[model samples]
Target: MSIMASRPVPRDDASWRRRRLGLFSVCLAALLLPICFSGGAVATPAIGAALHGSALEMRWITSAFMLAFGGCLMAAGACADAFGRKRIFLLGVGCLLLTSLALAFSRSALAVDWLRALQGVSAAATLAGGGASLAQDFDGHARARAYGLLGTTFGVGLAFGPLLAGLLIVRFGWQGVFAATAVVAALALVIGTRGMRESRDPAATGLDWPGTLSFTGALASFTYGVIQAPALGATAPEVIGALAFAVVLAVAFVAIERRVAHPMLDLTLFRYVRFIGVQLLPVATSCCYIVLLVLLPLRFIGVHGDSEVTAGLRMTALSLPMLVVPFVATQLARRIPSGVLCSTGLVLAAAGLAWLARTVGAPDTGVLCPALWPMLLIGAGSAMPWGLMDGLSVSVVPTDRAGMAMGIFNTTRVASEGVMLALVGAVLIALIGAQLPDMPGAVAPDVAREAVNRLVAGDMHGAMARAPAWGEAALRSAYEHAFATLLDRLAIVTLLCAIVVFACLSGKTRSGATDTADLGEPSTDTATP
Candidate 1:
């Protein structure tokens, strides 16, 4: 069992060097993935225009990546644990390098869509392996510091992605963004391959393919159904069929996991109330805040007539605070109870959203000055629980099961984001329809949906041209009214969720297979398991 016998590497200087190298490699992956995601958001319009992609195809460009990434995350986590985390991490970096290069040259929308999906799959592996590696390599206070940096990296990538992409797109077009990403991935691959030592669960055997397949099917079908529902009615055959299939697959996945000897996920993690609460923080944040990365750019470009670069710069208000707050949270953890900090942060975020909602409906609301204060509040508030949640997710599980635990935690974060996007889109489209009940002509619902879609995609001119019967002034008024209404409802729901998160973490922090002593003191539990 000696380190020398198993891997046969020098232990004196090489050990610390390996750890440092591994940490950087993982943080680099964290940094790059968000850029891939949010950069694509900034580049989507140009990509669609150049490829002559239809509205549906454009939607798929983002949806497909999210669907694949979320669906494959847990499976990738399990694979990393069974195989070597280093091997899996290297594989992911290699896949990303190749796919990003391919994406840069892709001329067709369909090709771009598929390439993005490949990138998503690789990203899933990279995140899972990288997180698991960090969890295994560092423990106690060191683990806290490492995760804090990881969270900061996540914020930097997410916050600056659009600004960087705006510059890239302006200078060299959308392809330049992907080309630059490829260079980063290539460097990670080389460092990770040479520096990362192999680590895995020695007791692990073969993968539980049934659980993986069922879970993948469930996520894919559900995502497709929800995304399509915004365009096709919820009752449409494709939507209904996909939803039904997703439900069946979900049930099957649960059943299979329960019976499997080595399940991809440990369902028992849900038994810990505090663990469940920690996981939900990501879901709540993604629904209430992270999704704004996509929505705000569209609002600025589509409704406000701002250029892409201008929109990206304006968003610095929201993202800049996110970049700094996680490091601050690391310091605050020594004094404040994590539970209290998380709840307070969520409530603050809700208040900010509420303020933004009220202001968005104003007659003369402009983009920057009016939005800056609220966006800052939202970002600062959400950053409180950001990295602490990651630390808690791993700390609450058995050491041997860190990979599965991280998989479940991150899967919850990402899948919820995708689901929220679809649900919000559906709500927005339905609200638009309700706001404009009758138009001048007897336009089909499909036709009306298409027009609204164009408006949402930042094509006010196209939307007006398509709906000539409806006066431009009236159409703009209706769309803005419906958008404001959507924000109002979202604010209410986010506030309620904040209360739920507070309640979940208010009681005693139950002990699990692993100790959470580092997280701080807690009250006695009042609620029964």
Candidate 2:
């Protein structure tokens, strides 16, 4: 296999460049995928004064899509394997276009909520399918580079979603963001139709309806419970039922997956210590990554009296790193093991979070400054693991079962992101409830603060406008406390990564072949078509 002895490999620089460029298109498509989640919430405060939408309604606009998007990955991943990657990708893009159009024309909060959910579901298919395609499309070392490129695109999309939305929103209003996103989705569909080739694992058959149904039901119930618990109250019947149903469905799903011939989700992957630990990445990522962004604005308003426009601009710090660093890190990871990079990135993120946590008492401008670097670290760290794990995940499964393996990966990433956010959100609310004050003319201080929480949580604009005499100051205190509580979120992520690597580094720190060997090699692993 000496370089000179090997047969001359053909090279097509133009095609190479074109394929390289395909990565960017995927990123552009991803950029708006997650943006749909925050559509109403991000828009509400900035224009709430003008639009007069309820804060609760806006929050739903932000969170509802996440639930739907996460709830469908298992099915979508299987769809990619069965129908073919490029074709399914087109379908996803088509759905995204339609949903974005619907969102653009949404007249009321409810319509926006439903459309956002649809947008999220479409985005989920795109995320899972597009990612899987990158794997099937690239070969050898090129695969790693493609992975990095894909990672960069995802990071860029997440980072730019807010910035782009902010600009369009400012220039043409909120609907502008929707319209622009629709155009992007429509263009993606066209490009995919023309250039992308279909990739279906010929051996991948036996669609797992039972597994899909059971897992979907379980996850849907769980996501509903988490999203609704805050608004529904602890004892609310819907929340309780959702939680109970989730628990039962999860147990049933596990039992079913163990026995089903072609299951929606296979449970044996968990036995691979590396996959199990890496799985935690999603939980940590979803819980801590966006949770603060969700809450940080309250700090800006309460402490510095900054407008929503200003707060959104400042968030560019977090978004920018998330976008830029992945492009850099993904390249470097070709040489460096993802674990070393991941550990280093987490340390950096922990430092950033620690600094951010310490600045809670400072001015809004100063307090948020600490977040910039950690945001970068988080972006890089997030990309590093995926660069390694995804390749490893795909390669380990038997060729016939590749679709199932990928489906699990996609389902876990989205589902955990949603659940983790809920976990951290609950912790933040429980710990930082002290910062919120009662709205105008409330009786008990605690109840009043909860009301403010409801208000801030509901509509900071309206809350700020009708706040009690001590509202601003009280809200500031609540934010300070919340920031303090955010430390717990960071600490959890840091501790989880540290513990997993320290304990299981021997398992996950190896090459793909090594991981497969250690995991007792899956029964039906396959090669690219």
Candidate 3:
């Protein structure tokens, strides 16, 4: 390494000030991006009407952005490391700002979807290297503080996005939300370009287009099948074809990663069980997370007859823990026992689901009681692993392979989330089939059709398309049943994740001796850090 590669200059007022501004830039971008990732789930009823799309397509609106956003992260991260972190991050913010502006003008579903894809591209470029940037700028103790702050910012983003979206959609309509995001992104971009310093570990990066393409294709193919499987039958020719393509592409991704000079991911990260397992939960946990996150809002707006503002506010209550717990957890992360944290939190998450299930049959406000405690637990539990898992995921790899390892880590979480959401949607579809007023096989033509048609035509904007007065009665019943069933599934996943984490830490107790030496490369994901 040349002296230039590790340059040291005066660290003064201007340098310090810009670093602070850069942090602000990254955090704002992080918050803005998730709204797109969430796909207006909170405002689905109204937005669905405005966009002239069905309830199902609303799910896809968010899911599609996740694919592009989370799917192509490795390539973006590598680009950051290769070209320069500050440069790529700024470029991503620019793209996000432009796409948000474009989205505000979008009329058709396709246009919104495409702009979101662009948003994902920009988000990945800006965010993948963000944590590393913080770690770079601050001293050791301050690095941890910065991490806690970053987590708080993300929690706030995740917490308030739906709430904000819901209110914006109700007061000014959905376009207002996009307009706000555009403004936020623009502000972040300008600050980042002027304030952020460049960061690169020159040795960690090189062009790896083939690796990027193969991995992305695998994720894209699989996610497509998952998203389509519930609406289109799993056995449908197109669904089957996508599934097949996914398998083949995934296998080829592994093979190419093995032979490439600058492989996008190092295949060896899996040897460490902790990183491997924690990443898996993001997928599994996310399945339940997405369902509840999407479903609660739907129930509030569509079934309970809450206004979008009211619905969004209730959901915000759910996200409050997501905002607060992570910062505190990040601070205690080094000192606390991860096993206890994850185990207890998982229990809390499961309990929250169970409580939610029990209260599902009640009106919207009733569910709040059971829902509140669990939200806190789930948020705290999930936050415990973020710093530890991420730290472990990359530190074990060589500096040169860090980008690929981070990429792999992120992809696991994102891809798993895609699969889990698909799974839940399939289950929900099956449940809905049974609940329909007519024969189960005939979905659109069922007895529910004429009434549904009125809603679809925008006649029942206030009354959930004039669904029966008993509709809440019926819908709440379905929610109770489905949510209970889903809670059981989550319990199983939580237990499994806990068991896996426990098994990985079967003997080792003490933490903090990071395994950095003699470690090899990581396997997959466009999430290269």
Candidate 4:
């Protein structure tokens, strides 16, 4: 090898300071984004009851936020590349701050939902721009370390969100969650505005308005259709119409993207099987694991009768490993292939979920500690590939398109998790309702619906009070049974996804493969860099 090839690239002190600022700012935003939503899961019961909301309305509180965030991500990414990353990022932080403050004072469920959706859009801007900032400023080992730290920060938010929210909710109610989010975002905005420099794609022209609209329309329509299916029935005209409209918009989006000079998403990237495999990791986990993070806390409070704080603490078994594994995986990637590591981690997750299913089916045990062992395994396995996969997914992409690529990547991930939460809620309610037919007042549809909603919303005491004639033991058994069945299905599906990921990322390819040595060419995203 030539000496020129072996020597490190030179960077001035000012350049180092600028990149460091960008890294710090983006990672802070990443850390706070998950906390903005995940922490609220522990406070759901309080939010629902305080607003006098039903089960479906409560689902919207979370799903609506995710939907808006996912739907706007690509457009936000394009805007970041065309305009400026620092500018867009600061704007997003401002939006986050304002919406969070409004949510803190929101009196109605509908108002909260709207605020949450706005928050999602702001989050989309921050995440898209933040990712682009890191990709634009760093390359080689520095890039790997920045991505690893970002992943770790993201993991910390997911892990600690509920725990922190639990304490806040106990101290100051559900509104405290939103209030806390605002304060953190306010701090980020101040730091980012002072330290961050502007970065954008010099070659980028005007935004792809047509493509952006079509894609957003498709996603929103499809999500609405699925989310409303349980209440309106799958065949209802509204549901059917929305779903059909989504299909049309999706087709239009593809056509527009293919023809446009500056497309929002570059479809050509999908040709790489490794790219496809890395993207699937989020989807697979969403279907098999992320749903549990939302639902399990409800189970603890509703079924097992644990306090909000206790329930959140109990979840440590599921979240703590993520804090450690992703950071460690950055080092481990040096010795192991990313594909093998990802597949192995997912396999372990599947096994842990299977154990959880069996434990839930025991019918006699009410304690949660028995299941902690499997939860630990599930968390560890899920964390192992996150940093590695995230780095690999963008590293292989042309540096110029990294912003759009990361946006698309995270859009699918967040959107899938949102969709899964809705679907799983629907399924759980259906399973619980199936058991309702044998209970007292089965002939009264309104009574049955109320009972089911209350149970699902983590208001077990209220559910029992509302249905005194219905035996407590029977209600408990039915919910436990439904939860167990859900876990069983998740375990099987996750295992299958792991196998598919392993196959796609297994073999070497001419372009690149999923290993430590394949960081690819230096980014050409910024003309001056």
Candidate 5:
């Protein structure tokens, strides 16, 4: 029997109360993911300052968490189904509480990094188990609303995380940020223990151990290679070995998935053209919107010398559109074809990126004024597909494989975010390195490279100390030049992705109908979260 079918329906008033309480607990736990994600970015410079970490070490503060969270999500979901959702959910929340508490007291950057990775593993379990629990508890309209609230909770966390973290940091230092998440996690644990029920899939197969290990290893290896390249040199033996190992592990993962009885990822899903198009939506947003959540904070607080509070307040322009624009896009999807609506939104974002690139480095313009409109445009544009992609993930696939499709789509969405963050940081570092030699008061090539690494790592004081010849003004100018170039390249990439998405999605339908007919599936109330 299916998992949901096996669970007895709640009939009594007390059972319903427990279900509601379970959902609140799940949502409470869900809020921690984004809070940790965005808040970590704001906390990184401070962490480095306090811990006396290097550029690559400082990057790990955020990277380790994201990479671990993304890599383990599929495995976590499988475990949730094979064991019991409530069992996994409680374990996850309990671990999260422990990790957050540990992070608050950690003395070293390396300790924080390792703890962050553990925290991410816990988060993956929490999300996978909590989402599965909700799926089992609700059906039809109720399921839709439950997931909707889950999505909104995530949005709220992303929108205000920096601001909240900034306030906490100002009042109580970096530890306050982790302490805040720990407090919320404690609440989630208490409620979940009191209310959540056990449920599991009777027909679930053995976990894909090989696939899980290989996939996680591949992502970690690849991200490490990328993030360390600028510091270790592209030709360094360690960088070369890591990249080569990543390729081998990736090949092994695909082979394992193809051979396994119940694969973590069904390779067959890639055969669908629309599935390919749907997956691109996340990649597009990762470039245009998600990367900014990390990079912009570094620019404002680290490079431009704004206070953490000012930087967080400035970030609201980039994140606030997430709260309102997705609803507008959903309403418009009823009239416009999904492909067109999505492509148009990307086009707007591309234009904004290009605009921001041109204006961001203008010396005379004020900090917030130069980037404000572009940030709004990019946020609003990216929000167009944010709500619809989840529904499209299932609708484009056969009904029997909808579950696999959703899992794959979410994994791609999240895994790509971690990969892109690493890739963009690498690219920005390279661009900055290239600009350093040409600036006035330039130092030796080796010294310049070290300074660039420190600059991009969000250690402005350390960077200045490294290259005393290049005053703060010259260092900032070079960084501004490199940042503008990086944005231009990102804009081009986003535009190309838009074209590919439009082409793949155009003139396709479930029953040989127009795009508008199929588009309605994603707009309906019954759509998946």
Candidate 6:
């Protein structure tokens, strides 16, 4: 029996044309999802400068979107299956169009943060519904090809988003970033409206409301506490309360998932050692790679005084390997054990991070600086598991549970990215804050704290304006030190993850099979929604 579903080919040429058009529409919409994620980080400095957003508000501009997107993703897929794929897809595109347009005109940071969250929700719907619709429209070989193209489109967006946003910002300012997203959303809406066919799963057990709410609440609360910790002190009542609430909700979510007839996440899957190893791949990448995508842009544009275009070009070096290295990793897996390949990749990334930390503050000569090699190394290293994680996600579980396995893997990947981004940003702020008082010409304690907030928020000009005592040179030096320290910590975490993943996957399975046999051929089906 084949792993993929089989569907009858459309007899008429017109039906085929419609399906092709639907693929293009969904692919276009899918492209915007990563752009929204990566581009927001590129635009953060400009947004902070224009809106005069405080540290917390600036963090929310990015965090709010990510949290909402990750929290709503699994539920959106369930809604698509239970309700109607085309209906939800169109609704998502329409809402995205509205939110993007609103975001383009918004003047307040708070308003932008709220709008970005809505955009995240809309993007989730677009991804889930659009993907499910494609699964319905084609199957077998055609399904594989369509999904392969969709995945490539997503990769392209992630790789080039910063560069594109930088070009737009340079020419039309920050609003141009949102304006471009709106244009893309509008095109997707028109094409999708004409081409998409409605479909729903007959056996769908409906949305898991309790589990969804609890999981979302837990993530949002935890993220809130982390992002606010620097500003409100870790022991502040609000911070402590939010953390406590998040813990309670997380426990509730676990209980709800165990009790529900159709849980969004099947917790029992964790019993498989291989499954646990596969899940850790994303967490590893998030620490070593994904967090850097956001932080590097901020550091280049804000701390280092690099232009948006320059920062974007620098980021391209970091992300470009993702477009090519994943394929190379897949081929290498034919000769090497997948576990060995994954752990080796992470080790390389850890080395790259360590190298990067040492080179970041060096005088920037041009676009290609000393940091370029480290960025490329990190990208190449992380791409290895990036290629295999999807296939491993499904293969580790029983074939009948492939869809559930895919969902859990993706949720772990995305949710971890969001959480890590928030945690790292908070840590960076704390690290910078700690360095401020010790600087040669440090200001008063209160003023130094405010400077730390502004500095971490990517408001370099504002920070200097607030604390002239700590001169531009001293401030920059402090930021460089803090950023390097954060990178070192991340490197250590990645190395630790690599060790655990290797152990979990290197061992023989219960069936007395070597893990390398599970590598097989890479799955062409899209595991992400």
- TM-score of each model, paired residue for residue: 0.90, 0.83, 0.85, 0.88, 0.93, 0.92
Off by over 4 Å in 5: 1-11, 363-368, 438-446, 508-529
- lDDT by residue (350-436, candidate 3, tens digit) is 666655555555433543544566555555555555435566555544455565566787777766665566566566555544554
Please state every model's RMSD to the true fold in angstroms: 5.0, 6.2, 6.4, 6.6, 5.8, 6.0
* Tens digit per residue, CA lDDT, model 4, 1-529: 6998887766686678767777787888888888877776777788887887766677777778888888888778778888998888999989999999999999888888888899999999998788778777888879868877887788888888878888888899999999998988888888787767788989878578998889889888987887676666668899999999999999999999889876777787676566778788997888656887878888887667777788777787898888888878767777777778888888999899889888884533433577888888888888876656666667555555565566668777887777777778878887887875464444355666667767877877667777766767878878988888888788888888899898877753322432323323233433211
Error of 1 at 460 (Å): 3.0
Order candidates by TM-score, high to low: 5, 6, 1, 4, 3, 2
Worst 10 residues of 6 by lDDT: 520-529
lDDT (0 to 1) per candidate: 0.77, 0.63, 0.64, 0.78, 0.87, 0.87
lDDT of 5 by residue, 1-529 (tens): 7998788766786788898999999999988999999999999999989998877778888889989999999999999999999999999999999999999999999999999999989999999999999998889888989998998888888888898998999999999999999999999999998888899999889479999999999999999999888887899899999999999999999999999888999998787777789999999999999999999888888888777888888788888888888778777777777778788889889999999998877653444567888988998888888877887788776666788888898888888999999999999988877776565555766677677887887889989998888789888988999999999999999999999889877754443212323443454434332
Candidate 2 lDDT by residue in tens digits, 49-134: 44455544555565667667778876777788878877777788899999878877767776777787787778878876777777
For model 4, state the Cα shift of residue 156 in Å.
1.4
| Better by TM-score, candidate 5 or 3 | 5
lDDT, candidate 2, at 3: 69
> How many residue pairs clash in model 1?
1
| Local error of candidate 1 at residue 169 (angstroms) | 1.2
- The runs of at least 3 residues in candidate 4 whose Cα sits more than 4 Å from the true structure, single-residue gaps closed, are 1-22, 361-368, 395-404, 439-441, 465-471, 509-529
* Candidate 4 global CA lDDT score: 0.78
